[model samples]
Target: MHIVAVGLNYRKAPVDIREKFTFSDESLPVALQQLKRTKSILECVILSTCNRTEIYAVVDQQQVCGHYIRSFLANWFQIEIGEFADYLTIYEDNEAIRHLFSVTAGLDSMVIGETQILGQVRNAFLLAQKHNATGTLFNMLFKQAITMAKKAHSETSIGENPVSVSYAAVELGKKIYGNFKNKNVMIIGAGKMSELTLKHLHANGVGKIVVANRTLQKAKELAGQFAGTFCSMGQLEEMLVEQDIDIVISSTGADGYVLTLEQMEPVMKKRKSKPLFMIDIAVPRDLDPRLMDMPNVYLYDIDDLEGIVESNLEQRKREAMKVDKLIEHELEMFHQWYRLLGVGPVIGALQEKANRIHQETMSNMLQKLPDLTEREIKVIRKLSKSMLTQMLHDPIMRIKELSAGRRGVEELDLIRELFALEDMLKEQARLPKDFLLESKPSESDDDRISPVNPVLA
Candidate 1:
């Protein structure tokens, strides 16, 4: 069996292409079940967020796993493979494992060392397990990934300096309006990113915060967290016209532009050319692009924050070197676990054959000497058992050592041939179920960390 990951991220695909492949919260379980049922796919998990969508799976066929995953995406998302095939990236075996570890460790995020991706990874793994989409392989792999991420964050200061798209947006606003104490901020979303932006603004001492959402209650709740006021989506245009809203931060799930050029033209006109600085962090972009062309209107989308993100990354990059070391350690542990799956049954079968031969030989001898005392017979049995154990101990130890190296499977095959254990080995087939039953609980379980709410990017 092989571990494989196929997907696109912010580095490989733009937000427009990335948004097309996203699996909504309501659609994730169904998509997972469907993918699990696909040919060659044994176990699966889907991780979808604003920036990326990744599918991790254990498959019987290494060469064709990517094709199957792409096919699954096409069927699930109802788009042709050509539409996204070029954007998709595939990794197998060790590369797949390393990618997952790096992603969880925050080394692969657009904002390096961001803590939110850790929680996102944990949520995806848990949801997959809950819906029975994961088996032995994924349960171990994902738990290890989560444990590694926690270690990376705790041991290093990668996430120490709070830098995110939201934080960057606030900084950009400060450039236009130096003193936020008198600047009125309007955040047009109730999601986590919007709340985070509001938090940054609150820290900067912004005045008159208003959160607008499709649902007034959610808007009210988010606004209440920052001691700000709320308004409904219907009231958004009215508030833009009536209030002296200096800066606007918009992040929403709308399919199209929430603030269109036609809608904003009149609002901008009413302001009589008062400069309105806007930041749109949504994937489908809540604010219209044409709004940027208007006089005295400055609009920045998610991609615009990259420059700000880059400038503040030197210190985090230094810390990320520490995270890379942690990933290497975790990767070795995963490899060792994988090796055990290959050799465990071989060792069991070898020992079983040795014990069988010892028992049969003793049974025939005892029958030939029927007059022997019960005590003598017991002594003979005990001595012969000890001799059999002693004879096999060295070979067993050697087998374990060989299994940890590069040519493990080849060396194991030779051992199986010598013992005439081909039939027994064939019956095992290296399926995840057999190993799960034979294996001990992973060390990660004892050290598993709770999911954390991200304070930074």
Candidate 2:
């Protein structure tokens, strides 16, 4: 099967168009199942975030697969085909496969070397699995992709910076507070972004954390896991007063400001102007934009983060040169395995022709010399099969070696030409008069490696 990717991402589509395609946490399983149900698909994953929406699927027919996926996506988002189609992009075969590996390695991310994408990809794969929307092809593809990501992180400096928007909030916290060891941080939402930000904080040994959300159950559930305090929205103002919260990272999905300048005035007063660092890491921001004008208050909206994140991006680009070789080497290894898969049918045809010749001669001899040499005839047949196997051994081994290096796909077509394999099966009709073709070739059941993922383990 061929690898195919179709979707619009941050580079090509504006926020409005992207938001329309964003899949909430609840929609992934259904989306995965829907994609897998399309024609020629063997596996599927849907990655939808505020910045981008992409689908990775393994399919057989590119013509049908591309249109089916595009149509499915357009229908799901309730967009007219002609209107939205222009915003979508599709990459097929090698281009699609390479893009996936590159993306997992942070090569194609908006933030040049973001590490969060690996986790995002893993989540998509898990969701696909949950819905039984995957098979062997995807199991191998994703495993390799994850492995590639790990290698990129360990061997390269790409993941050295937190390129994701969630972690950008942590960077902002660090800049404002200098040290989080003495800070009481309050996270306003219990979403994935909030959880990731908490992880970064926990690693840095933040003083304490508190979860204040609209739902007490969610607040308690999330807070308990992070060893933090929790309170419902009714107790938000009181919680803010009690914690002496040094930094506020708010990102709830509220329609308007969750907190206004006037609302935080009294809370700030109680702290004696402790320089509250507030980060509105949300769209339709969780706080009033005017809150920044308050004395001793450092409020950084998302725009302020771009500068810090950009510096981090610059550092990643400098270190990327070091990791470049590692990625190239890994891609070469994967390429080799893919090329080796093309030899299967050619080898099968060779063995089929040899076995048929042996069978026909055996039947003729057995009939012609019925009693003269029954034992001798059996010995000759065994010798003939053994000789044929030995003759074919060199070509098979060479085919494998040629398929094992960089850009091995280039060698597959050449191998097919050199061996005259396109016509090998046609020669089957030239069998001797007494020859009887076997019901099934002896090697027909041998293991085959498909080029998409020749091997994973």
Candidate 3:
């Protein structure tokens, strides 16, 4: 069996390209089912988010599964392969495991150390489990990754700082007001960025929120999330002046300033020189820079927040080093489990082969000594079985140890060849209905051995 991951992420694909491949919640189940239906794919999971769309699968080694995965994506999304293939990245086996671990740990995020991605990863895994898209390997792998992520967060400072721009904006707010509970906030737009900033503010217990946007419905929808008021863009100036808003967060798409000094001066004066903290996260500069010159007014732009984000990221990077060590340790544990899985059929085959030889030899000896009593025959059979077990114990232990090492798979292959256990192992797949009750292999069964079972050669 081979583990593979095929996807395009924020690092390799632009937003336009990434958006093209995004799988909505409604579409995810369909996509997962379709992917798993492919001939090479045995087990599958799909993780789709704003920044990436990744597919993880356990597949047959007889064919190049990566090619089939890419083709599946193209056909499912109705896009030409050449359109986004250049941006896709493929990781096989250990690399795929590492990629998933890094992603779950938030090391692969655009904002390093952000906690949201961990939740997103968990949700993706749960969705896959709910749809039955993930089988034994993914079930174990994803659970391990989540456990490691939890440990990383609890044992390290990786998720302790604010690394996102929205978070940095909140940090700035906290610095000025010392607390958000008493500060009234006015959001100048209802876009995703505004919603994110508002989420941070609400988490900090900010006072009443007022959302103003070009579309009153969008403003109301966003405001409803925080139990805040909503108003049209035309009412922004009036609301700002009348409500005595203390913090103004603007993230509008307007080409010009959304809040100019000319518009905010009177609002500031109406409050009798009360402090006003403004953050302009918009690209075209939502607030006039001249607003900074006004008394009791502090205005910061996107560039100002970037400096804090950079500093926070530097701290996160230091914490990430500790996370990397944790991941390394966890990876080895998973590899051990994986190797044990690979050696299971080998161990079963070896024991079966030994038991068969013991039974045959005992039968032949008994036939030549028909005068032996039933009790004596039973004694001989027991002694011979015990001796055979003792004889095979050391070699079995050695093979298990070797299988859990670097060249484990190679060692298992050698064991299968030396013991001539390949056919015996293959026969296991075709056992009769009462095979579990039967003492020996059946000759009539024709089922092929699972490719994942290493002893099948």
Q: Count the backbone clashes (under 3 Å) in each candidate.
A: 0, 1, 0
Please tell me which model should have the higher lDDT, number 1 or number 3. 1
What would you estimate as the lDDT of candidate 1? 0.84
Q: Model 2 segments beyond 4 Å from truth? A: 63-66, 81-89, 110-114, 130-132, 161-164, 173-186, 195-210, 214-218, 221-229, 234-248, 251-304, 401-457
In angstroms, the error of model 2 at 247 is: 6.0
1-457: candidate 1 lDDT, tens digit per residue: 8999999888888877887787778888889899999999999999987778999999999988899899999988899999999999898999999999999888888778888899999999999999999998999999999999998889899987888768878878887778699889999989888988999999999989999999999999999998888999888778987778988999888777888899988888888989998998887678888888999999998777775756568889999998888898889888777776666677767765765677678779978999999899878877877777777777777877887777777888788888889877676565566574787866332222211111110
Stretches of candidate 3 exceeding 4 Å from the true structure: 168-196, 202-208, 211-227, 230-308, 431-457
**Residue-by-residue lDDT tens digits, candidate 2, 1-457:** 6888889876677645665676767767777777788878888888775556898888888778878887888788788777767888789866776777877777777667777778888888887877888776677667788887887788777777577777788887887768788899999988777888888888888988998888888888888888999987767667777888888898776656788888888878887777788887765467777888999888877555655777778888877765566666665666555565565555556556556566777668778878867577657766766676677677666665666655456776686677666677556446663454544534522212112112331
RMSD of 1: 7.5
Q: What is candidate 3's lDDT per residue for 1-457, written digit by digit as tens?
A: 8888899887788655775686767888888888879988888889886567899899986357877998998998899999888999999989899989999999988778877777778988898888888888999999999999999999999988667657878888888889998789999999877898999999999998999999999999999999999999888778987887999988876646777888877777778887888887665467888989998898887656645667778888999999999989988999888888868778778877877787678779988999999899878877877787777777777887899898888998999999999898889768774666765546412111212233333
Could you tell me the lDDT of residue 44 within candidate 1? 95
TM-score of each: 0.89, 0.72, 0.73
Instruction: Give the candidate number with the greatest lDDT.
Output: 1
Model 2 TM-score is: 0.72
